[model samples]
Target: MTDSGPVLPWLVIRQDDNGNRYRVGRYATKDEAQKIADSLDDRGHKQLYWVERIGTPAL
Candidate 1:
């Protein structure tokens, strides 16, 4: 789904090796968030990155 609109609703999340997760940033689309995540992952750090949509219910 295309999420480019008035506001940024995508979130970039990062989790380190210890399993601590935090917010990295927000973007207008999933692609933007993924791009940042990819770049960060490529840095060779022992961390994991992923993107999530705002308002998504936590499970």
Candidate 2:
């Protein structure tokens, strides 16, 4: 039998009123994070982007 490791989730970035960036959280999938971003925008949040980590992993 072969062992399959856990798939790390995507990282999400969101900015507040003061332009300070913050990480919302990690989601099981990219779609999940997008959904949360949409919800934040609907709630009047600003500058939300799904950050794509490079070189080193976000986690």
Candidate 3:
């Protein structure tokens, strides 16, 4: 089926010092990720990680 809905971008980022290389969560967009990062920073959640674009998975 063809979809006419507005597309939403997504990305994944790994948390720093989490001990799990694959510990990551999906974000609606990079902006969303940045917002989360800011919150984490405010909470003193010091960490480092990466972010990359991901395609919507087919169901």
Which model scores highest in TM-score?
Answer: 1
Local distance difference test values of all predictions, in order: 0.88, 0.65, 0.57
Candidate 2 shows a clash count of: 0
Model 2, 19-54: lDDT tens per residue?
Answer: 677877776677777887777777754675554432
Ten residues in sequence with the least summed lDDT for candidate 1: 1-10
lDDT of 3: 0.57
Rank candidates, lDDT, best first.
1, 2, 3
Q: Which 10-residue window of candidate 3 scores lowest in summed lDDT?
A: 50-59
- Model 1 / residue 45 / CA error / Å: 0.7
**What CA RMSD would you report for each candidate?**
4.3, 4.7, 6.3
Clashing pairs in 2: none
Q: Is candidate 2 or candidate 3 better by lDDT?
A: 2
Best-to-worst order by TM-score is 1, 2, 3
Which of candidates 1 and 3 is the stronger one according to TM-score? 1
Using lDDT as the measure, the top candidate is: 1
**Where does model 2 exceed 4 Å of error?**
1-6, 47-59
